[model samples]
Target chain A: MQITRQEIAGMDKRFRANFINSLSGFKSANLIGTVDMQGISNLCIVSSVFHVGANPPLLGMIMRPHTVARDTLQNIKDTEEFTINHVNSSMVRQAHQTSARYPSDVSEFDAVGLSQYKSTLLNAPYVEESKVRIGMQLRSIQEIVLNKTELVIGEIIEVQMDNKYVLEDGFIELEPMNGVVVSGVDAYHSTQIIDRLSYAKPDASASSIRGHAK
Target chain B: MQITRQEIAGMDKRFRANFINSLSGFKSANLIGTVDMQGISNLCIVSSVFHVGANPPLLGMIMRPHTVARDTLQNIKDTEEFTINHVNSSMVRQAHQTSARYPSDVSEFDAVGLSQYKSTLLNAPYVEESKVRIGMQLRSIQEIVLNKTELVIGEIIEVQMDNKYVLEDGFIELEPMNGVVVSGVDAYHSTQIIDRLSYAKPDASASSIRGHAK
Candidate 1:
């Protein structure tokens, strides 16, 4: 159907605004700093975690647009290091608190009361309470011209996760982690375990369907 | 941890060949071709649908990077036209067949056996089997570097959905439509309907909670 620009803009304003301002549509623990030569620490809670590639195990997170200057963005760019911590239900409130606009000098960990630990290979800190934390080296940052948003891509350097959450093969049990799915904007959600279907492939024959019959 | 280029390539190859290749991703329903003086049709499928903007109702999809000669991509690019059809569970097999590398002169709808209808305002046709079809105008075509991927961004010009799937507010009820989620290189997925949570926002508070609760 024919629609005017005004109609399209009106329909999208609310969803767009919510998407930009909301925390993670899905909650993952994000650690806030890098370790210094003297063991100094910095911290922030970032919610833009995304898997950019599988082969090299790359992960990405978009920092809030650098309105003034952002510490997490700066540290990742300067030191080329950071860590991603998966936020479970227990860390929801604390993670929310980290999204607050604090001064550059402030430590988000101190503000939100979460313990930090050194990353295995990277210079960044990992959230001690997180069920899974991944250390990464910044790969590249692309400025998405359409929206002026920075897409920060990182290469996975090392991974550390609580064994309890990993399956024998590598499937992650996301339910117990209380992974949240973001919707309209700033809401938090707890996911329920639904049926986990067997993997399906494009060329698999009928025999492959047997495993999923269960 | 420091990994050699060999290791990276090995992991990338394995991930692309196995893990990603074994999953079920989306196969989209797309219609192409301009209606002649007499109504003739050309319809097909594209699996690379993606979102480009929240504001202005923008969306994007990647076409065969080498479609330098195919009529589908050419028609969309030449006429600056196309429609997006959301493939429901019922259309899975037919949708899959649309991907066959047919000659430009052949219509997949005839080859795979499906029907097509004209879009309301746009020149492109719409797959009759699709539950949700959106007519869009080409905004830009960007070629991704180092890859045979062409990112076609579009502005959502008009949307048509089964009334049953449209919710009280503007939120589209995606469950009944059996919305397919795409991943990796090639696959088809039927998503399990998780709980529909309230839209979250950064500014959410007890007062806003009460308002939504009502």
Candidate 2:
């Protein structure tokens, strides 16, 4: 089936949301943890996390700040800190539960029965169950004009993970941690590695690096 | 192992790239097809494609326009059109090869041996081997002042896919299309669905809606 611009603009609101979202393909399932001045912890699932830079260790995520994620964006702005914890397959159900519209007074961590682990350097709470955890400091917010969504860029202040998950070459293996991916609006997925390929070159097809190392 | 901001900044540049890149979890693997003024197809791999909004069916991606992706960015800026194609497990090697630094005069489509399927609505070329294809028109470019990279936002002008991949609820099933996710910088992995979950609500744990249907 082929859908044109005019046809897409005319799609049912909810259907168009699911369809357009899926077009972006698989996304990182991360539970972004934050806290207000009163210390009411907020945890919400975000799928737009993408690497921005490395030397500064920055990551970026897009959020409709005025909608379901208003609290997350607000908390980050007030505290200038947050924790990004990867949602694994085992915690998928609980992670998805964070999206529910909870009142500002109620902590999603308490509502969903997930433990909040506070790191030493940041006020943002981390998911104790997550194998991969990152603490972020708000760097910049760019307002998207066409859509009101804001692009939140954060600098990675700290990264905490198990030794087994971090390989010798600094590549963090997700399979061992049981990391899960999100598709469209409400679908979750598990991935199977197809072997890491060596750096590409114009002269030849890339070769699989055994165990991600030479 | 726990890594702090200071340590990350001091690590080897390449090592830091691999380490920090993995912290974002998984990303969508896409082969972006664009063409020059002379119709020389430029295909490149990008993992940063993300859903911006649904009403206008917008998608956004991050690219370092001044670097390896200069050709693709230049073509899109000049022509204001591009095709974003899913990179399945089978074509992952070819997709990765597009990242190789090719001369501006040479088309990556010719260098990589992928057939270019031109859609009537846009000047860009699509990958015939891709099961999920989307034609995008440039909407706006936001310069990420933190890094030199620019966020390219595109309106989803057209979508083409098999009927089977499009569910009744409008969720495009990527697993059926053999869609793969990328981690770090060079690793590719195929996904397995864990079933779509019901929309979250405050009252209960989200139950899996079998086959993405109620």
CAPRI classification of candidate 1: incorrect
lDDT of 2 at A116: 93
For every model in order, the fraction of real contacts preserved is 0.07, 0.84
TM-score of 2: 0.98
Docking quality (DockQ) of candidate 2 = 0.86
**Top model number, DockQ:** 2
DockQ values, each candidate: 0.17, 0.86
Candidate-wise lDDT, in order? 0.52, 0.90
Q: Which stretches of candidate 2 lie over 4 Å from their true place?
A: A212-214, B212-214
Model 1 clashes, total count = 18
Residues A68-184, model 1: lDDT tens digits: 226667676678887766666676666656666666666667767788877446668887877666667777776656666565667666656554644433344445555443333
Task: Report the lDDT tens digits of candidate 2 across residue range A1-214.
Answer: 7999999888888888888899999999999999999989999999989988876788999989777789999999899999999999999999999999999999999999999998889899999999999999999988999888899999998998986777777788998788999999999999999878888888888898847452
